[model samples]
Target: MTAAIRCVLFDFDGVLADYDRDVRIGHLAHFLGRPSHAVRAAIYASGVEDAADAGLLDADAYLEALGRELDCTVPADAWVDARRAATHEKPPMLSLASKLRARGITVAMLSNNGLLMAQSWPAIVPALFPLFSGRAFCSAQLGAAKPSPAAYLRCLEALAMPPPATLFVDDNPANVAGARAAGLVGHCFAGITELQRALEEHGLA
Candidate 1:
């Protein structure tokens, strides 16, 4: 028999919010007076971001590295502003998270993001603040990125949730597979409608 799901671990970017890379880059570029392509290359083409996500760099180190790459200082506020500008909230998804909590199912976020994002979640997604307070886990803090079993294990440990009783929801199939590999129930999120149905099947809705 399937273990009853007592917790839901969700991915933040594509699943909880609509992320626009262009908007993020554009905001950074405008803030720093640099070209968009330059900002994009500095953030993506360079290995700085990957290192940050993988926990190889701390927040201060990450920003200093970005500043070196862009040849301009990157303060925490500007970075947070750019991130906030890029993330548009999905009311349906936020509502679903709230509903899950109301149903006695714990809701948390496990995102493949840097420590900076972990610190900025309240400002980035204020609508989710009440529901996910103290529940959001970022890859940098976990010391492992998503699609890695270590990431799921660390998050589950932090939440004090057993893998068998946790449902992992992500927009990426590969991430879902990783969650399954880590002994948690996995759901590949396609849309809010489908997710609602899936929750119903799990007796969580």
Candidate 2:
């Protein structure tokens, strides 16, 4: 709500890039030679994922733990690739980030992802940093995730910016509300055009 916004944090999966979780699940299931439901259930039930995201587990250990939980072994790279398969580029928003960055606006990404995503980011969306300039703030690395006020607040704290000086955009309404709760301006992303309109509405465009 303030005109003094200095940073724009975008959510990766649904904002800058599109991904289908079901596709990732399908790929994991196929790679493991198991049913999709079983794999999905294992992933959710094992609860190793959040630990990995929180940086409590390394990629290798995370994958190994997941395999053990599911009763199947999968190479770490293969598992990363399976997750990568779900992503599709959303270039327009990326270009917009570049544009905003060129204007001296700090553009960055924030996502509720775990360790593997941080390691697999380069392949997931090639040349992401070129557009963003700022570092990718993965929730796993932050020790907090979106939909939690701590997540947004951690980003602001790390960046050394006050909440009023940051704008957070995410596809999830809960995340948007979390940003607001953290004292940053929150924008719910629908599409490129909608986000552009939001920027203008907030006098950031």
Candidate 3:
């Protein structure tokens, strides 16, 4: 039998790329030449989480806040480049995306990425960005980040697919739970192998 799901939506950071939050903090600390704790506190004080969760901050504001905290002038593009350097490729998941597309399943990316990151995605992962035929959704544009029903709903509405007919994948438990609450079949992504197993179990592989 064919897979029950017609579309698959993915979260970018932890799912598509191995982005270590600690590493990021370290990088920020190094750039600022300050203690990690100080950098982290400044990040929290800058309302980074709230802005990200609300999807209201663009790349400029995001980077500017970090720059302000660090007492440096890190441009948005520079920050994007730094993140790209730290990110490790997840080829297996990319292969899975290709397989899904081959099966005539619609694949889309829903990422809570900064505007600069979104703009630079094509350069970072050429294969992944254009693979979906330009159906990638960035939170900076959508104004709603993951773990929010609004984000998932917007993605579903954009894809013109029902929640039941869609599969949502994310490494964050909260994001997975949010997708479930929004009525989509959600999977907490551990790795490509585990994800493939889950998809097979769900009869979507």
Candidate 4:
């Protein structure tokens, strides 16, 4: 008999929550009182490549750095708060996770998130947190980020599941490739509908 898929690991930002890229840019621009393009460039140059991806920079720090780059004074907290308000939970994905659990497949989340944001996430979306019967594998705590085999390995170790029996889903193609290299079946997530179909085809859902 073939070994069954016992676990599914999900990426957080674009997979669980529609990452508000436009809102983030707008917030930085408003804080700096500069054009969005200029603020966006400054944000990229702030030694923080993709704040959400690295999970190192919080909204406040991200806005503050952008403001300083533009020589403007803006309250970082306000900018952060506004951006937070703009975030929306992906209900369909959460429903899919519930279905997976009903079928006895363990579900987990892996994210390249910082300590502060990870800590605050449960409050924003309580349902998402509990869907992971296995705890979340956050990069900041693990000391490694995605697209690095070490991160995926750490998650596998934590889940106590072998990579071949675990399915990894991520929005980034590079991350998906890394998971495959690490021995997990990987999927580049487009949306929940496609993901549900993939899971069904793989006998995971």
Give the alpha carbon lDDT tens digit for every residue of 1-205 in model 2: 2458788998988898889989999998988898998888767767787787677877788888888877878787777788789888787887788888878888878888887887778777775855654467788878887788998888778778788888888999999998998888898999889889988876668
Candidate 3's displacement at residue 147, Å, is 1.5
Better of 1 and 2 by TM-score: 1
Candidate 3 deviant stretches above 4 angstroms: 1-3, 28-38
- Find the candidate with the highest TM-score and give its number: 1
lDDT of 4: 0.75
- lDDT scores in order: 0.93, 0.82, 0.77, 0.75
Q: All candidates' TM-scores?
A: 0.98, 0.92, 0.84, 0.77
Worst 10 residues of 3 by lDDT: 75-84
Tens digit of lDDT per residue, candidate 4, span 50-85? Answer: 553465566556445555677786564555554466
Cα lDDT tens digits for candidate 1, 66-153 = 9999899999999999999999989989988998899889999999989998888999889888789999999999999989999999
Candidate 1: regions farther than 4 A off: none
Error of 1 at 82 (Å): 0.7
- In what order do the candidates fall by TM-score, top score first? 1, 2, 3, 4
Best by lDDT: 1
Clashing pairs in 2: 53-114, 53-140
RMSD (Å) per prediction: 0.7, 1.8, 2.8, 3.5
Comparing 2 and 4 by TM-score, which wins?
2
Provide the global lDDT of candidate 1 against the true structure.
0.93
Ranking by lDDT: 1, 2, 3, 4
